[model samples]
Target: MGLAERRKVMGYSQERFAAVVGVDRTTVGRWDRGETTPEAIHRPKMAEALQLGLAELDALLTPPPADFPECTASPPCDRHGSEGIDDMIRREFLRIMVVAGSLTTLAPDDADAIAEAVDRGSAEDFRLMNGHLWQVYQLARSKSSVNTVVKDQLGALNEALKESSRAGGLYEVAGDLFQLSGELSFDGNRYTDAAASYALAAEASSHARAYDLWACALVRHAYVDVYERRYTEAAETLDVARRVAKRGNSALSTRYWVASVQAEVYAGLQDLGACEKALGEAQRVADLATPVHPGGWLRFDGSRLAEERGARYVQLGRLDLAEETLRRALETKTLSRGQSFRRRGAVLVDLAAVGAKRHDAEQVVTYGGEALRLAKKTGSGYIARRLQALQGDLRTCRRNRRVVELNAEINAL
Candidate 1:
């Protein structure tokens, strides 16, 4: 029997059932209509309310569709011919984009193929494709321009959840995609949207039993609080995230990431001792030889610790420590090689802020100028925001011609 039928057999009205399950009536309605499934946290409560065992509840919640086909061929049979498949995928992509409130032009054929793979390809194929999309998003000059494609892919992933036989894998992928959506929103300064996405990602990851993914979602959520200067709230969130990460795979860098972000939050709170302790914990990630980062979703490999430490020191008003650490960060191969413009730009801006604090016009002009160029070239609002923060310190050197010119350039941005 289906969920609705089973609920009726148990003599519970939808309203009473929702009350028992601790959810809204519409959530129960959505479950009955197959619009959404019960989250993992709700499943046990639902089963107890319906007088069903865990396995029986799962079966009722996810009944196999009557028309699902069995593939007898050596290779999986394509229900839609190859040519028809492309057209169908394109239409689906466009429809999803419209539904997502985006009016983007069609993505190229390669991107279309990636979207199609999310629907019909193997689990590994989905992982690889999603990773590639993330790499593209990171390296792209215009981060906001990548949002449309990310939204489209998210739509495709939601559709895939409906028909996918591999429930665990699909849920994990959904978690990753939702986190990516949160990142895009965060980059655009949409804190509310970003928080919602991160919450959904945590739910999806819980359903998939992906411990690391769930912890990562919580960390991202804490970032929204951190950005708004709610240090205590962010610290509370990070405390939970740290616990969750501890339960994740030891081979993964999840716990270390939690430590890293916790350090940032501690710095925001101006607790230098707590910040230093957290940074020490985060540094252990560098020793882990095999960090598991599936699809590049959890890419914290301790490579950014120097810059992160520097930024934290800057926030704590330790200019002497900040300068030394930030200068070390700038000399790191990653920044010196020019492989990541965003990373290099952020470090440069921090150094300029240090110079501005000391009322050193030449040092401020030198570093701030390059950072501005990178912000313009990369269309990185993250860099632009950092530069704006630095601008407040530049007021001390307003009489200097170079400082005035730099301020004008930043104002133009």
Candidate 2:
């Protein structure tokens, strides 16, 4: 029997079952509809409420395939023992990775060898390869091209984790891979999946005693809240990230990244004084001569500070400041070279937003058009989303033919 049938057999209504499980009625409804599974925390309560053992609960919850038999004999045979079950689970994980297009290139032997190397405490090669994958992911014009390799790396890390003898180094590598997974999800606008990946990254980093990696994951997770307009939640998450960053290496500039993101959260909250203070803290990273990012995962080196500051100013409705900062960002060598279309597109969109605020239709058309083109060329959901925001601003100047055309073009993207 499924969850709904089990609940009915127990003589408990959906509302009462939800109360017993300490969740909303809609959550119970979602489970019944197969929309989402119970989170880890809620599963025990659900089992208790149904008066069922964990195994029995799992069996009921899982729908059997058409070819699978329902045992008619008493005391079902335990054909797949613990070892078999574990092997099956791993196989299923690999199958899902294949279906998701995350493990296309690497052979099973290659994955096994990498995992074995990590388990034997020789993780340098694995780490270096993962770092190269991250660099490729960042520099590639089509971000999705790197997903298969990253996913393959994650699969190898998971295999290594099954052996606990050398877990410390494996955890560290796993943390980095999780962060890369989060970045891939975020770039595709899968915010919920990104948040889950970041949460796992933080947990793995904590187990490895890698404070900077943990804090970086927290910062990335906070972005989900920030983008969703959960300002208070984002601020609270960033505050924890800041405290964690304090315990990380002073040479790494992790704290500076925390400060930079804090500025964005502050701008979202409209706290101008706090925003400026955080921005000032982020600026200190520019003074550090040595490279701050070792793995290419935490790539915030203050090169994009001008554009970031402009974005914060735009968030705060300071058009005069935003226009100047973004224009300066456009002139910066990094942006001027056009190597990073995502960065340039963001700056252009912000500048167009400023122009829309100032009712300068010509400026809006010029910047917005270029941003739209970059969005198409790069297939960047980040840039497309920013243009959607610009679309709202252009509506105010809809009377202008240029503004109307630009708005339509953005909508097409």
Q: Each model's TM-score, in the order given?
A: 0.69, 0.71
Best candidate, TM-score: 2
Off by over 4 Å in 1: 1-123, 164-167
Cα RMSD (Å) per model? 18.6, 17.4
lDDT score, candidate 1, position 56: 89
- TM-score of candidate 2 against the unseen true structure: 0.71
- What is candidate 1's lDDT per residue for 104-187, written digit by digit as tens? 123233422223444445446456657867887788788777654565455445454544433436656767777877777777
Candidate 2 residue runs with Cα over 4 Å from true position: 1-122, 163-166
Clashes of 1: 0
Question: What C-alpha lDDT values do all the predictions have?
Answer: 0.78, 0.78
Candidate 2 local lDDT, 20-132, one digit each (tens): 98765866886788645564457798889889888888787777754535667667744554334323433433443333223323224333233454355545645886788
| Clashing residue pairs found in predicted model 2 | none
